[model samples]
Target: MMRCGSVIKVKPGMLDEYVKLHSSVWPDVLKMIKECNIKNYSIYYKDGYLFSYFEYVGIDYEGDMKRMADDPTTQKWWDVTKPCHIPLETRKKGEWWAEMEEVFHLD
Candidate 1:
């Protein structure tokens, strides 16, 4: 499995709402994530920033990501949550969340 992490800022005044929304994530969106071979998906927030971590078990990264991205449930989910995010300006072009480099891992 490959581990990935990403960070995005919660728009001011939207942080609490974002957290609440995540507390009851959509079932279809969760199903899509699992169907795409993603596991251990988790999101955390602190100091107005949100961080996400997940494991990719799919061998075909490109295809799996494309499939997930194209899922209608996911698209609809993003439509609601996207406005609550503030992508770091320094993120690479076309990236919403700035991916974090893994410096260490155990197990």
Candidate 2:
């Protein structure tokens, strides 16, 4: 299994809306995530930033990710989430939420 983290800036004053939207994420979207071998998924918010962490337990990480993105339900889910996030200006090539580096870990 592999763990990944991503960070994004939440639009200035839309934190409430973002939280509300997530509190009731679509059923199909959740189903697709599990189907793609994503587990222990969670999102955290602080100040104006949002952090997401998840584990990839599949044989092919890229393939499972592609499968998730190709799903209609997941696509629709992104449509709603995209507007709520403000991508960093320094985002790297082909990156959506800039990948975060793990500075400290103990386990």
Candidate 3:
């Protein structure tokens, strides 16, 4: 399995709504995530910053990500959630969440 982490900022005053939306994530979107070989996904927020972590079990990470991006339900889910996000200006092209490098891991 491969571990991944990313971060993004939430628009001002949008934290409550964003948290509410995630409290009960759409079923289809969850299914798509699992189908893409992602596991142990979690999101945390602090000072407007949203941090995400997950494990990728698939052999083809890029392909799995592409498949997830192509899903209609996933696209619709993003439509609802994206407005609440303020992506980091420093993020690389085609990146909405700024990917973070792992500096240390105990497991």
Candidate 4:
């Protein structure tokens, strides 16, 4: 499995709504995440940033990500949560969250 991590800034005054929305994520979105071979997904908040980590078991990582992006449920979920995010200026094109480089790992 390949581990992935990303970070994004949460819009001021929107953390509570963001957290509340994630507290009970939509079932369809969760199912789509698993269908795309993403596991152990978690999102954490710190300061003004949100960090996410997940393991991808699929061989075709890009394809799986595209699949996830194409899902209607996932799109709907994004619609609700995207407003709460303030994507970093440094993030690459088409990235809502800036992908992080893993410098160390044990296990």
> How well does model 2 score by local distance difference test?
0.90
lDDT of 2 by residue, 1-107 (tens): 88889999999878989999999999999999998999999999988999999988989988988898889888889999888899988889877798888788776
Tens digits of lDDT, candidate 4, 2-104? 9999999999999999989999999999899999999999999999999999999999999999998998889999999999999999999999999999999
By lDDT rank, best first, the candidates go: 3, 4, 1, 2
What's model 4's lDDT at 92? 96
How much is 40 displaced in model 2, in angstroms?
0.8
Best by TM-score: 3
Candidate that scores best on lDDT = 3
TM-score (C-alpha) between model 2 and the true structure: 0.93
Colliding residue pairs in candidate 3: none
Measure candidate 3: CA RMSD.
0.5
TM-scores, all candidates, are: 0.95, 0.93, 0.98, 0.98
As for candidate 4, its clashing pairs are none
Query: Which parts of model 1 have CA positions greater than 4 angstroms off?
Result: none
lDDT of each: 0.92, 0.90, 0.97, 0.96
